[model samples]
Target: MAVAPLFGTVTLPSAHAQPEPPGEVVLSFPTVGVSPRLELGNNVASEVNLPLPAGMSAVRLRGVIRDQANLGAGFLEVTDDNGTFLGMVEIPPRSARPAPLPFDIDISGARPKGSSLPLQFLVRTNDIPADCGPAQQLVVTDLAAVYSGDEPSPVTIATFFPPVLQRVTVVAPTDADPSEQQAVLTLVSTLTRLYNPQPVQVRVISSPRGTAPPPTGPMARAVVVERGSAGLAVEEAGNPGAFLRVSGRGDELTAQISLLDNELQSLAQVTRARVDQSASHQLPTGDTLTFSQLNLEGRAGVLRRSTFNIGVDRAALGGGRIAGVGVNLLADYTPVAGGDAAALTVRAHDTVVYTAPLNASGRVDATFDVPSQALTQRVALDFEITYTPGQECGPLIAPMEFAVDPRSTLQLVRGGPPLGGFGALPSEFSPRFYVAMDGSGQEQLGHAAAVVAAVSRATSTPMTPQVVDVKAAAEADSGALIVANSVAVEQTSLNPPIGGNRSAIDVGLPQNLRADIADGLGSIQVFADPPRDRTVVLVTTTDAWTLVDPLFGYLDGLAGGWNDLRGDVLAAGAAGTPVDLTVRAGGSDPFEPPNVVEHRAPWLGIGIGIGLAVVAVCTATVGLLLWRRRRTDAAERP
Candidate 1:
């Protein structure tokens, strides 16, 4: 007998069968690093890069505006950086209960320079009120662009990637060999780095040996990886779109993937291309670097209070730990009025390092050393200026202007504790690192790819990985990413933060306390190998390998991936959220159960004493209540 399907499908009426209109895609300003709420003064302006996707047309710019200044007669103007007017809206006076005024301005006439639309927002007040406060401002917020169009299909290698992409799927054979797997991992890292801050989802899927990959959504692209004669080609796929096919054997496969990293990839404006060989250009490294060398721009502002950060990354020192840091700051500011006062303060990692008065010279040249305790993987040098206006606010008064020159110098002295944990990653593994996988084959390779890709996203520099055996990676003096099960990890000389067999595992907790967990657990731990003087990141599971999936899921969910991870280890069970375990120094004993039990003995005795006292008090109260009830019953009977 034939069985019906579990669910039934209903047909819609003919009226409802009409084709639906094209849907709108909303792109928020914050996605491109533009703050939704922009505070502007009389002549101040803010600019944002609105990425224009291929085949999509912008409908309008929509946002809310708050006119806090009560400027009854002014307009908020929108213009291109080149002074091309696009649109404008008049500012209205503030209401008694000021509500957010909504604006929907049509920007159909706006044209993009290259692939992005550079739009500037500014308020121009022709006359300033005599009684206005010094903090008068205009706030613009909740900004977003509405686009309506279908994504265009890519016909060449250059056009294959759009300005905005939701996801990219890398498809490989179900039984992919070592080379093909490595190529897949390389592609994941390369694409993730290229689309930094965009949060593009790069994933992998396995298909049959000689079959086509499953279809993808309009906003997503799929690239098929295979083992064959070397070449990178764009093949036509029916229905939705086309898929990129990259194929080669061993090293050739890797070289083909490297094409994505080349600036000349735009020259491959055809359907097919072959890369004989490819090489990556290494960035120049040294002890001292100027702000401009690190791609930092000078900050300039006209306000009572202004602050900016000068970020120095450890990776900029070529995978070395920071021993000392020195900065020669060059700044310029408007001279304080006769009655007004101003001061400049500098901080490293939020700790005040230097403070000085703003002199009449209108220039500051100060050199200072960063504190040792303030050092981290990424050091932030904050420069702040506070200006107090002495006179009543008026149009005739000059606004405070301050700036930090791009020529400011920073000197880094390398040599300190080889930082352990996630903070040391990406930087410590820079230039090149080794990858060692156990006998698990494709599954292990997939995990390695996830870890590699997550680490690559944390830095601007590209990291090269050489696949080697476990023994080679263990003995090498360079950083390594090791993916293995409990058995494999125990064999390596490298020590992980957490260790033991499947039946029982030693968990490193704070305050010299260690717990023995018998349940199946998976963990990702980072530890410094004192012998090799290198950092090692280990991914292992006590029992089931599937438990490791959640650990990676936790990492992927974070906006910063591995960069956001803290502590030394991340452990999880068969189900539930992963726990961030930090192993503190001076612990009673890391892996010794007897020491941990002894340490807890005092607390255990105190807890027993409290419980016994509570029980005795309850018993006495019950006995007295029963005796009183019996005496009252006897008196009533008489």
Candidate 2:
């Protein structure tokens, strides 16, 4: 079944992006875009909570239905969160034969509660009797909610969360009181969970520290956390956390990091992004799973025998294997032989996949076809190389090496039915580091580290990003996270097609944001590598270094499901609020494709050194030292 799409303003290059019929917001639920048709009890209904911006006039529900006999009469009943009848669309009771078909449902009378709406749909016996064994197997996906109108942009709990907050100001009183400060930090932490959960170098601004008044753009949203800053001598109403929404365009919400600590279900409701968190190692098929920008050190060497291990996530196998499309492990190795007789063996989960005798000379590789059923949660691949010297007792050791190129890859070519949400991004299956920039300066490094940290936390693994230059990025085969200053962006030629130079834009705004500050924050834009189909490219800037903290805060601050980040670009500055982007005139300097795979090769360097030491111990220099020590001992012998 077509699944609900992951929400995010990701701008994919035409190559990797599937051309869907144009619509405002198209979601493939479960992320992998497939849901099995399970047995739905009599009158048992399924509820799908949709993130529909205001002006969502229609909803198209697509799914598959099956039974002992394909013909089954059933209609989907639709209702609002309040269970208020919103009307239902009738099915013609057609035979849902060979495939899962799509059907549209026109909802009326009830609209979204406020930007987000929950529609409970039930596909059951419309008129037929309930048959337990011969039940109507129904599966739904690819939920497309069409919206009209361009809403004003700004940061809000809704954006930071749901019920998107438009324009609002949150003031917390503080005067060096540790408890109050701690409370504020907690509040920021919760916001970070949604906005930029990564440590993006955010400077805590007390209510009175700034030279200019708190930012209040036409559509701006600011959170001021201080001890008793709200000046509420008495108890106040609304916004459950420790703080309240002082005032803004027209939002009445209260928040504080403590709310999350306190388990404020109300606030948690708005910030639903956290629920989408999952491990990073699991990958869905089709989309490539690789890290080309991870920073790592290597340990090289020569050895008589060596073993290289790799992990394979069985969950990514999608519960079943499909023909023609299975996991493929491509291993490329360069052999540095010291002996004439050498052999190599490779295995997957203890099952020997390939074996070949090393020519005792050059590089060789073997591609392994992995069966899905054979995979487990932590399957490992072991490559063993054995070498024998022509001489039985030789003092010299050959500098033999077999280095698996970083590009040596493991890819899932999924076949068969829809696997649901797996290898899609901004989610667990997505690659970390949409873009990685060169370590040009401390500021860049700091922000880059922060992103790596965030990805690590999100994936529950130590994250390392492969930093690449604009030139290398252009040739990169996998998706990446590219970061640079405005000047660097220009040099790399990854500038946005629309809008004047985003980095070089006139420091003009409704309020004089720059009048008092040196520079504010930064911005991140995600795009597809035009040359690489299905590959995503993220562009972040530190041209205005001073703005790095704010920019980082904005992007990582908002936790939009901790999964699919909605919108094309996410930018934050001195304003401290991250907003989705609208990019145009698509163009970028594709980085080098050599890309990244974060694996530490221990034998790449000193493998021969260890063996050489054994031979070196037999040398004249070693004999001299041994003789001198023995002579000295004899002279001192009592």
Candidate 3:
């Protein structure tokens, strides 16, 4: 099957066939993290980051336009950040019947800045009427880029990762050794994090030892992980594409894989490289970090209404749990003149937390505490400035200017109860974590890789993993991803939210209940290991290991991966959709027994009432039978 690109599907010639001529490839704006719809008013411009794959040239920008204000004569203009004109689409005046208008503008001469083409869009009117309502807004939707060219083949390690990727296939031996398995899982996490927000799919498949796997599609890449002399190289596959080989044994393998680290990968300018010695990358240290430290920069805008988010990731806390959070906000804005209304509102996790007038001193300096309920693995502090000019329509009206300082500080207090369920993860397992497999085999490794990849993609930081036995991981203080069968999970010290034998299972706490579910059932559960003060994620199934496939499918189907997962348990039968089960106020402690009284009260009452009704029915039947027998005897006597 052809790999799906950001916008549409493009099929390339097979590896064994002759190369096909270059064709048009469409990339939609929304797929690359940009809004496809643009709402522009007079004199306002919006910027979009357009990704142009290597060797591909931009052809045109196509979309539909909705002229809400009925501006009779206006044209939409496109320009680069450097003020270079790209092209324009003329907007026709409203006709007898109004409808969405189609537009396609040629931008063949556009050049990319790095891997992305930065372009600005604006709608200019030929004439502005004195009675123009609401400033004449134009809406452009379904914006996409049409590029012409085939993707370039990589000759160096640095260039192997293209600007756009759909899938990555990691090939390992059917009997891969522990080191090789570790390498595969590590690479999965690395690549997933590297191409986040792109919805890239990473699959692990096994082949015979020392045999190269089948070639991948044009938009996909294949990587071979095997144990051998330490090296990382890109070798020719006798086709347009090449496969990457990461070969090493034990620590040597880890050292070689480190070459793929985001900070170090760029140094590998050649097709092949060897790492003799390498140090692990260190995460940021400290309880307080500035916006700059968290990779957030100052944002300035000239719109009447502007908004931006300040994200605080738990991974930035160096793997520490958060007990409390505080933010010191620093901002500057144009003071509102008399009769003008302007205010700045701050929201944490979408709940309004703070508000202040923006008409004083042209600056804002304030500190506020974040509510505990708003805390998660990642917290978004949304800052929005709304300014209404005093004049409805006046030439003297000045646009609002708002800026957020990068020097703003976020203070996190460590040592809180491990967050409940999936919210605790990636953060709880950050910096370094353990993967404990019931059996260190290819199947187990594949499952572990999938779990790690999904979790890694949710965070901006890299999570290091060490493969060990179940006992070692369970005894360790750090969080662990445990992949095992039902019988194996039963033997561990960790308690899962859902547990039972092959024929019966007990769902504890909030979902307090027990049932005889003979069918195979798969489950992915998270619970707090209180004694160790760590989190444990358990992946297992009741009888057949094959049943667990759907759980992974359910996770993969989620657009947000781990972030989309909720509750303490995700359980499903062999042929059913996964269901999320929450433990509620009981905390996510698996050891906590089911709330028998609370969950079973209704059932218990029903059982008692049923018994009484059965007794009454039996009594009534006996009485009626006795009466009928007496009447029969009387009739016979007569």
**Candidates in order: C-alpha RMSD to true structure:** 12.1, 24.5, 10.6
RMSD of 3: 10.6
lDDT of 2 by residue, 314-346 (tens): 333332333322333333344534545777777
Per-candidate TM vs. native? 0.81, 0.31, 0.83
Q: How far in Å is the alpha carbon of 201 misplaced in model 2? A: 15
Candidate 1 C-alpha lDDT tens digits along 419-486: 57676677778777888888664567768878888887777777777777888988898889889888
lDDT of each: 0.70, 0.39, 0.72
Among residues 3 or more apart in sequence or in different chains, the pairs in candidate 1 whose N, CA or C atoms overlap within 3 Å are: 512-588
Which stretch of 10 consecutive residues in model 2 shows the poorest summed lDDT?
596-605
What digit string (tens of lDDT, one per residue) describes model 3 on residues 1-638?
21222222222223363432358777777555567888886657888888767677777777777655646666678877887777666665556324666656667766678888888888777766323144567888888777788787778888777777878889988877667777888889888887777777899998998787687866778888888878988888335758889999897887787777645777889988999996676776788888777777556554456677767566766757777889898887787788878888999877888898878588889999887767767778888877776677555566678877888888878886654477677788888888888872347777888889888888878888888888888888889989887787777777776788775766553434454555756778787887888888888877777767777888988867787876677766645557665643323332233452243222222221132121211234334434654655566694
Sort by TM-score, best first: 3, 1, 2
Instruction: Identify the runs in model 3 with alpha carbons over 4 angstroms from their true place.
Output: 1-22, 30-35, 66-73, 81-86, 90-102, 126-137, 298-304, 336-340, 389-393, 440-442, 510-512, 583-638
Model 1 misplaced stretches (Cα beyond 4 Å): 1-23, 30-37, 64-103, 124-133, 138-141, 237-239, 333-340, 388-393, 508-519, 585-638
User: Candidate 2 regions off by >4 Å?
Assistant: 1-43, 51-74, 80-100, 111-118, 125-136, 147-188, 192-256, 259-638
* lDDT, model 3: 0.72
**Ranking according to lDDT, highest score first:** 3, 1, 2
